[model samples]
Target: MGHCIICGTSVDGVVCRSHQEDVAFRFTGNHPNQLTPGRFYEGTVDGFADFGVFVDIGDSVTGLLHRSELDRRLESLDWDEGDTVYVQVTGVQDNGNVDLSWSIRQSPREFRGEVIDSPEGDRLPDDEPTPTTETEPEPEPEPRTADESRNDEEPEASTNGGSASVEPQSTAGPIDSGPPERVTVDALEESVGERIRIEGRVVDVRQTGGPTIFEVRDETGAAECAAFKEAGVRAYPEVEAGDLIRLTGEVERRHGGIQVETESLKPLAEADAEAVVERLDDALEAEAHPGEVEPLAEDPALADLTDEIADAAGAIRRAVIESRPIVLRHTATADGYVAGAAIERAVLPLVREQHDREDAQYHYFDRQPLEGEDYDMAAATSDVTRMLDNRARHDEKLPLVVLVDTGSTAESRDGIELLDVYDVERLVVDADPGFETSDVADGVVPDDGSITTTVLAANVACGVGDVRGEIAHLPAVSYWEEAPERYAELAREAGYGADAVRELREAVALEAYYQAYEDKRELVADLLFAGDDEVRSLASHVSEQFRAKLDDELETVRPHVETREEGDVAVAVLDTDAFTHRFDFPPTALLLDALFRDLRAEHDRLVVVGLDEADLQIRSTEGIDVRELAERVAERVPEGGVLASGVRRGRLSFLIGEREAVREAASEIAADLAA
Candidate 1:
């Protein structure tokens, strides 16, 4: 046994140092008793170098898999820094290093065993050859000296040249290493104001304060092309974002780390041409169906008008009033009613034509009885007096209209003090004289106008006509049938038509609903305020009246009606204003909420909800807030049962309003689905 001089390791070998110019070898002092050669073992590539790979075989020494042994497919095998590949031991040289290979053409178990033959396959017979006592041949002539051998290794001189092979000189010398590595557009370093080429997908094109910018992208990344001043964008004619372009210019970094600085650009048609064609196709298709691409929020005609009015009025007054139909004991009274529209009331004699004084009087009155009627003149007179105290009060400013018709008897004297003989003043009257002082007045009047002063008191106390209460109160059927011309005339003067009337009537219904809601709110407030049953009683009483009124109005309006009910909620979308006088919001909101609850209970789950003008439903309700309404319903709905609605701002806007609730519900539903 001897130690290796190179690594200080114990080994059994002949100690020899055979260092030839081409190869070197070292051996320890020990010799093998029995040799096992040509044995193969699996190995791991441990290290890679330009010339070969070093593989470990669990022995202290490693093996070599030269580049020449690699598969032809990886011809120029440029191995990565860390790659471990399988290899097999091929041979062990006189030196310590082992030779390895990956090819398995030779089976290890079949071809490897003890060394029985020399390298040239010369065999030793079963018995050793006897050594003849032969004198060794005379020693060969003394070998040449080391210097002589070294000189022989030198290149031989060429016949007509200084040296047999001049060293091949490199045009680029050492610096050329190899052909400079080919750089793709992606590989170039990005620097501000540096002229560099890059590629990316075009994402957007929009105008900034300076010029139009379009985004382009390639495999590496995306970049923005700023078409600086004068909008060189036009030069690119059809060029847009997403159109692959080969831009050439000095790069500039702007707005932080974003890099951009373009002097000239060219569209890389091959890369972006397909996308451009697709965009053109899309644009062509859109042109083919122009109507479909509309912004999401658009109101229906009726709704648009409602929104206009609501905007103008701040808070809209929408109401509906139901009245007992006039049996019209006779047709004889119809002519008098028709003629009454053009005739001034008997109070024309009590009016002064001109007002020269700062405090001139304006006289008006509703001859309709208030003794037992819903409207009390004394109360209305008091309201008028309060209005009169304000300097801003005037006839044109007040918006109520009293429908006056001549009843068989007059109740003005009974309920109104100062029956006659008062100072002369101006008088304002309802445009529709058919309403006169009769029982039909309240029935014809909108539910919301029940608290209004008559035209007489309104004109006398405040210089205004109660157009809302009086003129608009004409019977819908009668006005359209009996006095179409007069009704048209009033509509024209009012700067609207039947459509406006219908809208106003609907608005009135909404107002009444709001009032009903307010009444409930007030009752609740009172109950909460007082902590008593009195307010509750008042609320119940008012609700009963409201329901009865709704019934009466429905009777008149639902003559040619159709209705669909989901639960306790009955949505009777009428074709005319005669349906329950007008649309009121409070009862609608409460009723709808109750209906939803009932549906929830009946179906064992709420199924679906349908609404007309869901936008209006959301817009009109200030209490019970639409957001809260959505939340309340969202909480109770099954994963799939929630159905809220809005047709304006976008179909999803309605959902957006309820995002918090929907998000929560969605998370729960998703979890359930996952489970």
Candidate 2:
């Protein structure tokens, strides 16, 4: 028996079977079994087939390099008939039909392995690394010799006289030999701005507009490392997913997360490939799960909805880790903005943590509000078009659509069904529990009148541990009318007073109308979370402007509003299209909300119908069914199709031909109900 050159273990030859593949051995035997299944071997391109390329391994054997084993198409193969290449034997059948796969590195010399045979058993080309003394502290390793240059260089095609070859050479010199100071991906947070080295297998490779992002997974967790070559050009062209590589870069803290700017990346030898892959597998198995959730201590009722919250938290966390983008859809109101912004704040940080791109927040997370209380087919079509464009241009994965405050009712079924056709991930975090939202959404956090959508979103944010402090006052900002006691305290503790919360609510509402197309990201965030010093003055100014405009419109419209008593209920009707400013500040929706709340405590609100041309919107309070009223209006004027419009938005429309008849009929119904 002889000692193995690598581990110094006793074996039948100079190299053991475990480390035999590490050394590229020249085949001396005449049998097909002598070739290692996975070891790269030198071969000559014989010819091409429709399915694969034929390769001549040695004088006695020819292998078929199957097209299925190639990373790209078979027609894209650039090798000529006589050109030499490298391939791995994936399988050898009973018929001696050798099946081969393409190898990125055609030169076996790029690897650390080298073995030779004589009259005696096999022997390695070099001696094992010498052991250092244990008494003294371990010093940095010395530079490797010419024969050990493979320890530093990245594996690719090695040239021999301008032609690809499998022979090892002494041309390239040694590299930094000491094992790089290794850090797990999870430890990147504490080592921000510190230059560190991390070794892991590449799980994914993405090319962005600026740089190439490689998601590397080590024993602790996964993180993105960015390497730049040029605009739209791939960095580290030879590096592919599943390659075990050692990356050297500085840990940068940006984008509300941590990323490594790669200075150097060297693919490790095949000898340690198994170990690296196993370590990554074990780390993923152990760390893939999101942390367990605890109910918001401030709200005990959340305990009743803990399971759904946990599921939401898990889905969000998984999306971040797996590099899936999040698209948030909310109602286009103050409450909707608050809920959408809260999740945006939380998810941005996590997105920054998971990805290493300056625009990763925008790429990974989106906050889109519905037109009103309805997420109809138009919204879903827009989402599909936008996401499909992103997928085609940037090669982005399908995003997780998070519906906030809306999309819980059956009204959003068609929109949800459209998204379902693409198998998109949907999560609904809503306060309304009246409808079966669970039938559509993968996870639904529905609380019946107990909390606001912002509170539910904040709970999910807190559970995920991303946007904690930033969204403190978001719940209070959502309450334009009245905030719940628990969330109000949270806002107060976050340094926002009741007056400040009111100003923010009014400001967000005002801004949400003009740029109804946009999320008003920075403006809303500053007003809600940045405090009195930064945005309070702006908030106060905007609030004054908002109130002044709202008052003027209400004063002008109220004098013209026709009021009638029916039984014990009083109905208020206004020609909103003519009386109020249609193109100006306060939209009909906000105007009605403020007008109704101003009169709710004093007047019995059977319904407030705002007639605009052929459309009518109803703000019905005191449990007066708007649907029934719409039906009555339709029956009174048979020619007018003044029927119930939508189940959720309390809307009805009349035919233009019968507008005058509907007007006459409305006055009759008002007088007949007088008690």
Candidate 3:
């Protein structure tokens, strides 16, 4: 019976067996899976080569059994190109080359092949010679015993295949060691059933009714990590958003989406956080868009804002200078720093100097109504009027500066302040780089009369320099010439003893050296005028004048100048070297703290503020002192604050320098005061 090579079926069983056999010689097909090389297969020889012959299988491509890998010995084999022969798929080279051989052995019937016999079986010869035994003995007949009967049962052997059973693998536990398999930002996509650990900083955090959603961002991008309220509230009492945290969790693709969900989180320390942030920044390339910022000033919204600022400033000045009981419906500072000060300045003097300078009724009304506190406008008015009455009675008028700076903050949307100026009779003044179109549009309503806002372009100081100078020299200039000994004695008692007092004399030399090397300037002039008291005196006067302006403006216009001076004129020495040491920043803070502690012991009621060289204390002052003021100013200013500042901004530098000087004086006098 012939079989179909392609389908592996017997052709004899089919109806068309006779016709199929004729075509079967010309037909071809392939073995299912040819793993071993040098194996021959029977098929029509499709093509020929010097190395091998290609035999066509029923499949599209022919299989080539390489001559080198073949087990056949080809000495002389008469095979036509079209003849059906066997070939094997030999070694498959990476370059898509194939090899073949001719002589090969047929497979056994028991292996996979079927026996092919001749169709015509001739009933010819059945004669065959049988070999005779050489020396055969006599044949004997034996009788079987009754006990050896064939029906007796014999012992049976076990036939069931006894295979060893495999123990099942454990599935219930956490991984012991080694870094968790790292999944990239892209690879995190397909991982649905796996556990993962993500390292990043907590960018944003919000507590919902159910869980706290936190955004953790590394260099690649940000991912969301959620902790249940019960867990998060307990875990994050000491830390907040912007802290560095690591999360380990079973990942669930949210809504079958791509983002990973972390189930647990742990906080990272400052050093670890800093290193991570550094790496992230290196990857992110965070950059400031200076061009973007500059164009913002020319924006239409900014133009409108400038007009409103002018109006607010004009109203404030008129109300303050004219001694009118001003009721500002709305007044806003750009960032609330200066504007807040402006508002306080407007209300303060009415209470302080009102008793003496009563020209008109003095009434001030202020309450942070946002919090629903009832404003005591009436009581404030009575108090102001009484102060004004007293000032008038004493024939004294306090000099006040109406500080007019630019308009609202970059993000402010409130325009009610502009509308209030129109409601009241006041004028507006324009500062440099005046208001934008948006400010004008927002400043007033369309159908109403516009506020009488003036546009003034003048550069005027608030005399704070003069005031600060006067206040600063109050201890020295006031009594220095009259009683130097008494003044020195008082300074020593206040914690600045002889050493600190002596250091003040050497301050000029120190400042000179600082200017020479640090400022990169020739100190020839300073050296020539070294002992010239006249020159030193002039520089001291200039410094005092600048300081006084700040002091006086803050003192007279705003509240009384709150100063925490560590050095006292009564007794002291200055450790100029300690003041100028370029150690890490915190040491500066500590030095200032020690200075303030000593100063606080003496001036129980004074507004103790450090200025100039002793201003380093401002870096770490806890509350609303020079340090706090420095911090606040730094935060409000776009030019980075004291902590985050560069050398050029020098706001912090100025504070630090001033703080260190005060600290030096206090340190020099600490022992003397103790004695």
- The better candidate by lDDT, 2 or 3, is 2
In model 3, the number of clashes is: 90
Q: Which stretches of candidate 2 lie over 4 Å from their true place?
A: 1-203, 207-219, 223-303, 443-447, 466-468, 532-534, 624-639, 642-646, 660-675
In candidate 1, clashing pairs total 54
Scored against the true structure, residue 515 in model 2 reaches a CA lDDT of 69
By lDDT, the best candidate is: 2
Cα RMSD for candidates in order: 37.5, 16.6, 35.9
Per-candidate local distance difference test: 0.32, 0.69, 0.33
Model 2 CA lDDT for position 527? 70
Residue-level lDDT tens digits of model 2 in 1-675: 666654555677655544443445544444576665644566789999898999877656788988867755677678899887877676678888887875645575644455654334455545644322223344575564452354346432211111111222222222233244678888999988666788887767876433567888888778888775543357777776666787766687544566787756667655555677788666544454445665444676576777777678778876776677888888878888888887777778778887655567867788876776767799999999988997777557788888888877777889998999999988888876665656777654555566677778877877666556667777877876778877788778888889988988888888888768787788888777765575578888888888899999888788877777765666777888889999998888778777777666767545566777887766656433445667788888877978766544556778978876776565445333321
Residue 568 CA error for candidate 3 (Å)?
55
Off by over 4 Å in 3: 1-178, 181-193, 229-238, 256-259, 269-271, 282-675
Q: Order the candidates by TM-score, highest first — what do you get?
A: 2, 3, 1
TM-score of each: 0.20, 0.62, 0.21
Instruction: Supply the TM-score for candidate 3.
Output: 0.21
**Tens digit of lDDT per residue, candidate 1, span 424-520?**
1111222222233433222121112111122122121111111232333223212322224434454445444454334333333333343221212
Over the stretch 428-449, how does candidate 3's per-residue lDDT look in tens digits? Answer: 2222122332342222211111
Q: State the weakest 10-residue window (summed lDDT) of model 2.
A: 157-166
Question: Sort by lDDT, best first: what order?
Answer: 2, 3, 1
